[model samples]
Target: MSLIQTDENIIAQMDSYMQRVSELAPQIYKRRPVACVNTFGCQQNVSDSEKIKGMLKKMGYTFTDEPIDADFVLFNTCAVRGHAEERVFGNIGTTKQLKRERKETVVAVCGCMAQQEHICDRIRKSYPYVDLVFGTHVTHRLPEFLYKRLTGSGRIFEISNDNNEIIEGMPLSRDGKIKGWLPIMYGCDNFCTYCIVPYVRGRERSRASADIIAEAKQMIADGFKEIMLLGQNVNSYGKGLDEDINFSKLLRKINALPGDFRIRFMTSHPKDCTRELIDTVAECEKVERHLHLPFQSGSNRILKQMNRRYTREDYLELISYAKKRIPEVSFTSDVIVGFPGETYEDFLETLDLVKQVGFASLFTFIYSKRNGTPAAQMPDPISREEKGKWFSELLKVQEQISRAKNADLVGREFTVLCDSTAGEGRLSGKTLSFAEIEFEGNENLIGKFLKVRIDKFTNLLQGSVIE
Candidate 1:
């Protein structure tokens, strides 16, 4: 394994950059500066973006929604799939003219895409005008990266080749004033053959539980009401540490925190979804009654091929156990259709499992090949047309499930946490079950909760807010 996949080495880099980053802060504030961040990929990336924004703000830069008006444009990119890569490349190309127009403008690229050797190679060769590059691990070092860009000394600042470690004290600008993403852990230890996370994010290293609680406490003090605990694999949190704390224990600890905030986590592997964890989830009042368990494929054969480390029966049992323990508990899942060698019957099995489980919502994707994954080299690949057809079929069934689930909320009341801006005339938010709710309210309702009654819904969504 690469040294970048470990923890000890990363802590050293943190101290190095923290000292340098602070020294560079005053320089950025001296100039008339503006920054724009274009993000792609997961909640982890969103959390990274929040920190990036926080870092830039500390350096006295304002944000702009338009790239053309900005003095500094940063592409917080993703390489999770081919389509995401294409979008970033397009954005970079389009931004090139803006850089040429304003020769002093700092153009940089960062995120998981920066971790890949090939992706970095292309950026260096074809996009030399790009002043700075960094990765997931180097988000805290972003201030330093930008510092270099502001001066004439700009070059690629990607420190992604080093080992992974938890960088405490990184500030964040929460997207929602009332909600925040708290990372319990970072990176992945599971090298699922189709995944580039372990390669790009490097290995699993957990933050100290004490630090996590301190952050949560601070957020609570700041009056935040909802916190989503983010991780590539949340269940694997604390297992990599010396303290021997498990995820369930962490959840229970947070639930017992001196606050009324709701707690949520994501992307659990079925192999690690133990009865204890399920029971703990059922018992914790603060823990939301929703779980985002990603079943990449339904067929045991295909699962084995993806190196999922669990059989189909194992997943079904876990689902059954979780539902039994918390009947009111709803589920959302990640499913990939048309994986390599995935027969029609295999696809049907996934459909069957989805219906059997009756997920509150499902995030479905067509199997897009990733360059460095083992599944990428496999023979008998699913064709684009076949993948498209399968995706459509999967969407049809999922839409039905979603509609039925939303319908069940009729005449029922739910507590929704409002985060986004109100639309033309109504407020938009998410319920505890992660259901989308749009209700009428004043602008002041944007960062608070409302007891909402399901008033009506279209074929796609629900309408709400208590009388």
Candidate 2:
């Protein structure tokens, strides 16, 4: 079968659960109204929510931000971290209160968290008021799920199956018109002990190169200036290729597409980051100079315990590669404090690494044990107060480094594309290095890249337009 047909078949199978619901409920009644979708977790989840919105809009439902004002409430949730799952549970409980207050409103929950068997069982048992529960693969089936629920032929339905298919031809209502999100890969195969993404999102799968390139070309045709590639682990892209065309090759291909579009990718694993990938990133003019390489922990002991498969020395070498080839390269790292047996020395190792690398920014967090992971079963005896202490220490150091990085931008010109709201008579966009900057400009300057000479940097983003 062709790609589109294969995709449609997978979507059909995912929505098959709704057929059972339809047997009990029926489609005679007709009503369509506004819905609010709450998204949790990473950019991938946000992209999925957009697809859900596109599907709902086709079904004659308007979008609303306020849940109370919306006719239907849907949650596109994440299960990567324990805290995120707790938040989903809390939201579900609150929605139950909403159903009590307003019996007519329909409540639905979908996304990765819905793929968990235990979570699914609880939602079916305790929250019978929920109209539907769907998973990652069935985003295109929202219409069918809603059709059965509204027509009085079906009760609640849930779809939580292991699916690996790429869907196309759905309308996309993007969050930002200037910067588009392009998915090159999905799911994770690494299965790090501290992560639940592998279990919920399933194995790694790469989209066909032709399909991805075509989609990106259309985005460029529509005047999008920037494209951020989305994936669980992007370095593993093109592993599905027969001739071994990797992400670096993809970068070169997209860069030579005869457009001025800027390229960016997120959440790279230090393990899969290879010499070829480094060289491509360093040399490709179209690829941005910033990298988001996530080094979860700094201590070799803790890293081994977490099954990260890389030592601190290995990470330093990767940093060395970037430093020599792309001297001005800025990097952002993910740091987790208070893992199961993290000690004072371990925390110091993290601090030392952060200082050694002088990261552009750090997404620091206190570890929250995910349920199904091996790390969760390990003794997490660290107190909340201790975790907070470690987190505060990490934050203080990262903030200083970030402030210095931003401050150094002063007396330099950066190419920024206008996107978000700027102050009165001003525009806000990101530097090619991903630094957020605020600058004043006439309305005509919007949507186009302009050279802004940084007049001031409060260690906060403030730029002045060149006269």
lDDT of 2: 0.81
> Candidate 2, residues 1-467: lDDT per residue as tens digits?
22222466645653454354333222221344667899998999988887777666555567788887767899999887777788888887778777788766779999888877788888888878887888876666776777666666455556655446667666567777788889888778898899888887777778777878898999899988898889999988876555457888888888888787799998788999998998998888889888899998889999999899999999999998988888468899888999998998999999999999999888888888788899989988889798899899989999899898888888888888777667688788788778888887777776788778887878467888664
TM-score of 1: 0.92
For candidate 1, the 10 contiguous residues with the lowest summed lDDT are 1-10
TM-score, prediction 2? 0.91
Off by over 4 Å in 2: 1-5, 8-32, 97-104
TM-score of each: 0.92, 0.91
Cα displacement (Å) at residue 151, model 2 = 2.8
lDDT of each structure?
A: 0.80, 0.81
The prediction achieving the highest TM-score against the true structure is 1
